[model samples]
Target chain A: MSIGIDELEDLAVGAAFLGTGGGGDPYIGRLIATKAIQDCGEPTVLDLDQVKDDDFVVTVAGYGAPTVQIEKLIGEGELEKALAKLEQHLKKKVTAIIPAEIGGSNSLVPIALASRCKLPVINADGMGRAFPELPMNVFSFNGISASPMIVTDEHCNTAIVETASDRTAEKITRAIAIELGLRVFIGCYPMTGRMVRECAIEGTLSQAIAIGRSIRQRPPGSCAIESLMHCLSTIYPDRESRVLFTGKIVDVQRDTADGFSKGSFRIEAFGSGQSAELIFQNEFLRVCVEDKLVAVVPDLICVVDEETASPITTGALRYGQRVKVIGIEAPPQLCSEQALTYVGPECFGMDFPYKSIATLEAEAADKAPKSATAV
Target chain B: MSIGIDELEDLAVGAAFLGTGGGGDPYIGRLIATKAIQDCGEPTVLDLDQVKDDDFVVTVAGYGAPTVQIEKLIGEGELEKALAKLEQHLKKKVTAIIPAEIGGSNSLVPIALASRCKLPVINADGMGRAFPELPMNVFSFNGISASPMIVTDEHCNTAIVETASDRTAEKITRAIAIELGLRVFIGCYPMTGRMVRECAIEGTLSQAIAIGRSIRQRPPGSCAIESLMHCLSTIYPDRESRVLFTGKIVDVQRDTADGFSKGSFRIEAFGSGQSAELIFQNEFLRVCVEDKLVAVVPDLICVVDEETASPITTGALRYGQRVKVIGIEAPPQLCSEQALTYVGPECFGMDFPYKSIATLEAEAADKAPKSATAV
Candidate 1:
């Protein structure tokens, strides 16, 4: 429940740990958060209990091609462009700006805005981990629409859409990004602080900090992976984590379409006796063993560099790079028919049956789910 | 100024002629318009001058992937869904619905709703010919913004984006598409009859009908291109047209990102000792001769099957398919730095100097501008 200034760094690192590969580079995110904290002083962490249901809250994040942001470096005040419009659309004073998720650069984007906007940071996110779609947010799962959404790009171009359905808003956002040549910034999902508190994955920022701190404090020869495993065990005790593979990337192919990075990579065993190929659209959604489907979409598949333990994005996945692939059980909420139908195996074009991440983890865990129903 | 029911068919053909090969398939568009007319009777066509500036006119068209609409056909009540949101956003009665552009499909989309919604159809459009960006409408060039836009997909999903800027509205729309898995549907833009009249390419529906009729009524033994060229001469003697080359498609590559099918193609000359490479994003903008730039961006570069005379998209361009390359002048407004800069050669990664389609035509006519200072 408590997140300190120094812990922000740890949280980012840990969020990167949960990125499941392909959230985008976290360097800009870390630097931005660090700068915000140093300049604005530490941000006060607000607990869920403090937020009244009627208190206005806004969720902010960057929306665009990760590859483009790395080069263009969204101009200063770009996030503000969308925020300004959001304020106009809501016609209410915003009490806080919450990070939509904890992953890659997005983990830092909210920090950048909060430092400049003088808003408190919510210690929760819509997704417990990360997802490619806006509607996939836990807030949406909890019955909150992402409408009255404000989106913008660094060029100061902003849009505020009040859609009858969140899906329409999603289409509009995708189209505008395409029209802008595919890179944009966005502040969306304006809700009451109470709605955020009730719907969000609570205490995630604090959890991220703990996981990050544990990894950073670990001594040499102590596996960073083991530290993460230990930290997550405390927070997600019912769930299990498994080190899927340790290998060197052999090939990486990527395509950026409609603000999503769709691609795949092949990895050869470095020391282990196994090799694998991973496929994804924005996240490492599926993994295979020698062309045979092993673990599929909606199951968490993260690849971190073996040495630094940094998560690798699908776009950044390169040949000749050493990585440790990690698999973790997805939250039970993500296993609902609606959730699986969207981010599951069928959504990504696999004919295979839906299998829970717990099932995959069982192959590596000393003990596994009894019936494979635990996602 | 004079347009008949048969003229509408010709205009549809001509609009497709000017579409430069990247509007959604016109067949479905024609069918939709035809069916709407059959069911609801003819739409009342209003001229620009007939519409007052303050008149509530909304430009409507579909937003999302064309591929999806082709499969599902648009839902019957979807337009109503979009209109409901639009009416709320405008907070006024929509007196008329106008075509934003005379593209293959959208040119007729409004027709489907004309009688059902009891809204008059304006003969004008934002773009006389289709251009990808929403703001590319002449209305925008004339100081009208595309904000307060209404977008609806086939799923009865509707959204209203009322932003201070048109570009911001576009960004929101793009984000929505990205989130919705690239669903396609209708959208209304720049909600003022005056702006609609000024911005909507005037009499575009009439143009489409004329062109369609001309192509269908062409004399036998006259190929599609020759017949169309004759039609062009008759319709627009002020704008010169040239059959640049007759060749066969050798290669085609497409990248559908950001709602635009952008990329390039190569064609082998049939009898001429030359080959041409063309690049396009939404519309064919640049063409090169053996890697040396021949036609710059901002000018129209179109490819039609030599015998069939059907326009081919860069995505549909295939190897060994016989094609005829044609060049035409763009509107003077599109030739300006403000317009050309958006779709120019540099935007497409070409290093050629921007030459107006008029200037290019002038060169072919021995009337090329002799001095830079002279307009």
Candidate 2:
């Protein structure tokens, strides 16, 4: 389906809602996407099955510390700069653009690229949630390389990297980010539609839109606990979604180093007379409720306002604000030992082993395992 | 004098010593400079007035937070990235290179550029003593524009900017740095030898080398207090210099924002039952001794280790370091209202009016002023 002018905001909002709070802010992304869509005209989304086996699809996103972007706004035409160069290199019309990850600002980045290039945006993403490193994506876990990658920044600085190994891409990307200045607009991960379709998380855009709409139309005075659980139930039916303690943010300790937002937050529990803390490297990976480890790495921990049910982007969450913390099961694909190696609690300085969100919840329940639910 | 392999180490050492702790660590910078010298042959210094009026010149330096550079070392040839692009853009062979600033890593940045381009280096700079902002430089203050600048990062992101205003150039350059990821290499300030002669600080390189050598050759048990005063007295025989206090740092606070280091520091007085505090934005502008304002801005308030005679760059002066703080009369040119308006104590966040460093020193002497008596 092709996007219309009015649908841009909806799509951008949806994308940001699903960003799970680690993407850079979506305002710049939205403006650029809107402008690109206006310039190239509204584009359509191509189905994975419709794309040929060899069709080349490139994933694009901004790389660098998010803190810098707020101080120094991006220059014009940087996104299209790398895109134009990539197209020139390929000498082929890009059939579609795909979101590499669903986090704060990047969720909308691919949509913007697709709208600007007048190409369809694939319905899938490499990560079901946000991650700090490049190779942590599902595609990389599936043995797909991140190289032959063309990365660029707003200054029109570009690099065509052909790495010896996919792991090298992370180092190269980090170095490039450091050299470029810690924040850059980048385009990478060129893959065929078939490879992407098999590796990517499908229908994330629709999922994000639905989540955004749910929050937007949330009933007044209704606890986000029920609405979010209802939404999760729509996505995962068997397990009963539990409402974690409601609390006010007491502190948000953040340090942007080595191209990642490495920090944690503490929340003083209000009604429950308990405190909650979450630790993260790019995305919320662990949550501790009342000094008990309620959730661990490989689980998806999200924080939002209790009243509004609106998702809080990681960077936007600050102290003295009331929020409702929620935890959900990460897709089984991300629970592997390899996946845990890069994004697990250990990677975030947690002195604990990886525990699936489902397993953690079931352990908390102290009951028989329920039927497996498909997402 | 040409920089040969024989003197590159000495030069690099001298450059780092002169950097006064702010240009970043000289390890990687020395490597790059040495490699460039080895690769492109020795670079010779050219006197500005000696060049023809039509001779092309450019300034080269790294543009970004120094912290970013330390975390991710610049890639090979990163310094030449912007220079190469600028050379291509102008279609004119750059005959010489000059340093835009002479503090921190910037003091040595030109060595790499000049060696790589096989260009003669100019012995002058925009600032005899470094000021944080681009417009505060002598070149900019003297009506030389910073536009037509080319900025790039190791990622090969290149930006060619020409602005009507120098402030716009600063903004754009900073934005591009942010885009390149916060660490960028820049080649800028394209000007003719005539402009260079008119606006540049002549013999700054020689000055730094002399100052560095003197600091290094201090006699045993000789305080930096005597050595620095001797050096400055020799350099500026016409100017007055006074040691305000000899003490160790007790408290230091700083914020690196808007491309300037703005902060304050306090120290416990060496002998008296008192303390001293100084406030600054880029340069040491104010000093208060025992809650009494002792010195003000448009003056030079340099702090150095009492024993080592090593000058302390503002950002590098930390707690527990014994230092001898000196107050020197600024040059007549720098004592003007224009200079004070740009760098006075008020500009940094003090509530006092400008006071001449000489007059302040006279008041502090509590004795008869010496008249043209060389120490």
Candidate 3:
């Protein structure tokens, strides 16, 4: 299937929903991808089954502070430059492009470059949802090397990192990004089609498009929260999707530290004394109501505009904005023991044990407090 | 010519003096070079005149914080691994290895690697005296690109930086160094033999060896300060060398901040009402008597043990130690208008105009009270 300019808009909306307040703002990415599709022809996007076993696949993503992305926008051709450099280092032609994460800017970066380079993009991604760290991707958790990664900036400066560990590569890449204007294009995880099929979160691109289309097709006067939850449930039948809270943003405390936008926000329920708080480092990692855990990653904690169902990124969050908090079960692959070791709440220095959204909700219902179980 | 174990010691001693308190303590480098020579046979040492114009040359040095180098020593074969990677990138045999800076550890790093890699050691360096930043090197000032620079650490991780400017390269390399244990082996400024001959500070290896030999040849009870002065004058006849002050270190205030050891030391004249203070960042940059600027970079301010004339790096400074402050004129190349734009005192944030050591001493002589002239 070809991804045209119209498809890019849908992809952006879907990516923002999946981003869960990370992955960076997608507005610029959508514009860039739209322009790229217009300048070049629509890019071919191949299903996982269509990829040859021997084909070489690479993942492309934007790495930097989301706050910085709003102002220091990437110029056209930057992603292509990064991909070209990676191909040169690998000494092989890249048969296809893939998103490192299915969120915000990262989701569209691959399509933008693939269109310009006339390469097909794989209809899959390393992360089913947005993640703040490189290692949080399935490719890294499944033993794919992040090495021979090429990072390029708008100024045409490039750096190739070959590290012994994925974590080290992330560290070095983040440091370089900070040095090069706080944002860079990264092409990494060069895997064979077989490896991609084995480890990738398959069909995330189509799923995102479906989600975007569903949200857009909602009728006027329909409850956005109910429509989005129904859309998510229809698309991901095996996973639980629910609106965890509905409130107005009361407070947002943020600081850009250690190359990450880290902060917490509080939401106060309308006509009720109840309030919820979400803490994040790039992506929303945890949400609690009255100091009791309601949802935690790798489960999704999505904040969206109540009226329009448009996702709001962490960088875009502000006080007094009415929003709905939605929680979706993460893919089983992400919740695996090995994956949780790196992506779990412990990784973020939280002492609380990880429990699924369903389990937390079940316990809340069993407690026999009507107001507490209202979510 | 070949550099043996004996020559390695001399090189280390001389390099320490030339380090002006920055290149990190050479004790470990000397030990490593000595062991490498014993195992691999002495490496060939080639003079600039001996190199053919077409021969490929690369500079190798250790980039890191001096305080860290004392404890987190490199494992064997690290430098060789870095050079091998660089050669692989350049797709050509490195005819000779040169020091990026003629500083304590950096000066010997090339020789140590050359001994094992079977490459000739070039009798030259990019920096005649160690400076804090990579752009302060003569090669950079003379328009050599510091691109495709490879940085490797003990863990075998390597990063290749191709930048549009040398300053960017330095910023990225330094950032990577911080990520990779605050110390790394950097192979940069790949050039032809002709480029080295045109831009490199030639004969620095031989000059260091000569200085080392002279310091060693001093009689046990002879006046070390006077003898060292005579040795320097005899060696660098065109340059001015003098003891700037003779006093006891009264105070030392230092802090390791931003990957640099920065602070100042105060010295009180022996049995007199006189004192001087020297400020440094890795390398000593300025010296003042009662807040009056006496000597400043790109000139050299060296502090050595009063009794033995052993050079003390900024990291090893302590209070109440008897010491002598010596000033030497920087090479004319480094003092050139273009070179001074980045390496001069003002570049270090000092507002004062740069004046050569000779000029500073001349002004002091003209304004001298009888006691002040004693220096």
Candidate 4:
């Protein structure tokens, strides 16, 4: 299927929502992807099942602190050049490009490269949502290595890292990212088509598009947010997706260090004393109301503009802005015990035990007053 | 000339003295070189003039904090593997190996790899004495690029860094070195034999061997330290090498950070109230006696056993130890206006202008009491 400008816009919107306040700014990515499509024809989007068993697939993404992107935008040609370097190192042509993670900008960056290179982009992605680190995905949990990875910066500097473990690869790449000014394009996690079929999150690109379509094409009399929530619940009944809170951002404390944008923000419910706090490392990992976690990683926690329902990424969060927080269950593969080790609360330095969004929400409901609090 | 275990040992000792208390521990490197010679054949040491201009010459050395080597040893196979990676990247065979810097362990590491790989070892080097960082070498000062550089750890992990400037290359390599636990082998400064002859400090290896010989093959009736000093003065008459001071170490302070061993030490005259202090960053760059400047980089400052002339490294310095400090004029190449910008006192954060050891020594002599005090 050829993805046109309309599909690209919808994909960006849905990716921003799914990004849960990390990834990168959608506007910048949409512009770049849009330009690529116009200049070099629409990108071919292929389903996971369409790729042959023997085909080679490579995941492409930007790796660095998102805060750095606010001032230093992703420039043209870095992604294409980095992918070319990876191809040269492997001595093989890539069968298709796959997003390492689905995010506002990240989901489309690969597609832009695919358009220019005239390669197909797989509908699948490693992480259904954006993640801060490379190894926190199903591919790593399923024993796939992240090595033989190439990282490149705008200055044309390239570093090829090959190591034994995904953890080491992440470390080496992060070190390079810090030295290279915290913005880099990585061509990594080289895998076979069979591996992608077996381990990747399927149809993420299409799912993002569907979620975005609901927000854009709400019924004339119906509220856009209601339509979006309805669309999300209908699409992810198993995920138990829902709006958890609507409030004004009260405070935020963020700082970039060691190539990571890490901090937390507080929000107070409208006309209520109740509040929620969300702590993040690139992507929002934990959201709590009254010291009780309503959502936690690898579950999804997202912030969207209250009235318009457009996604607001972690980097764009501002004090006194009205927003709504949403929570959705993680994919089944990522919810496994083995997968949790890579994205669990403990993995992010939180000592709390793992609790599904369902269990946590039900517990919070049980503690609230009969009328149900706004937060 | 075939470098036997005896010559290797002498080279290590002399390199340690020239290491200016940085480089790495000589005993560790000497043992490794000795074993390599026994396993393979003797390393063929060739003069700088022996090779043709088109021959491919690569410098091989370890890059990281020398203090780290004291606890974690330099293992086997890393250099050979890293060198092979570099060769594969360039798609050409390395015709010869040269020391990136001449120091206790660094000067001998390339020779050891040369013995095993059956490649001739260049008698010359980039830095006649060691400095903490890569760009501080004459090779970089002479417009040599340090990129297309490959760094490898004992874990078999390799990183290839390519950039426009040697300074950026050093920063990237150092970042990786910190992540790799501060002990890494690097195959960098890829240049032709013509570049080596044009820019390299010629005969550094042979000069180190000679300095070691004076300490070992001293005239029966003469003091070993005296013989060593006489040998140094003869070898670098333009440098005017001499013993600068003799005293007990009264105080010392050091710490390892960002892949460098940096600190200062104080020495008190045996019976007099006068004292001297030397500051270093992996290498001793400056020394002051009676609050008067005595030596500074790009000059050479060394610490040796007061009676035996065995070089003592910065990592091995201890309070209350008796020692003699030696200072030698820097090579003419490094003393030039452009070269000083790379290794001058200001490069290491010293604000004082760089003054030659000859001038500083003459000034100190003029201020001294007639008949001269021991300090």
DockQ (C-alpha based) per candidate is 0.23, 0.04, 0.89, 0.85
Ranking by lDDT: 4, 3, 1, 2
Global Cα lDDT for candidate 3: 0.87
Candidate 3 lDDT by residue in tens digits, B52-147? 899899998888888888888888788888888888877888888889888888888888898898889998888788988878888899889998
| Candidate 3: segments with Cα more than 4 A from true spot | A219-221, A369-375, B219-221, B369-375
lDDT of 4 by residue, B12-37 (tens): 88999899898988888988898889
Please give the CA lDDT of all the candidate structures.
0.69, 0.68, 0.87, 0.88
Error of 1 at A136 (Å): 4.4
Best by DockQ: 3
Task: Assess every candidate by TM-score.
Answer: 0.65, 0.62, 0.97, 0.97
**Candidate 2 i-RMS (Å)?**
9.4
Residue-level error in angstroms, candidate 1, position A254: 6.7
- Give, for candidate 2 chain B, the lowest lDDT window spanning 10 residues: B13-22
Predict model 1's lDDT versus the native.
0.69
Better of 2 and 4 by lDDT: 4
Residues forming the 10-long window of minimal summed lDDT in candidate 2 chain A: A366-375
Interface root-mean-square deviation of model 3 in angstroms is: 0.7
> What lDDT tens digits, residue by residue, belong to model 1 across residues A1-375?
534467667877777767665444577777777776777766666777777778788888766666665676667767765687677656677878788876777777787777767777787787767777677677666667787777676666655666656656666667766666566676778788778867777777777777777778766678877776777688888766677678898888888875687788889996656789888777788877756455665667778878767667666778899988887777766677766765667766788767766664445454445564565
Of candidates 4 and 2, the better by TM-score: 4
Q: In candidate 4 chain B, what residue range of length 10 has the lowest lDDT sum? A: B366-375
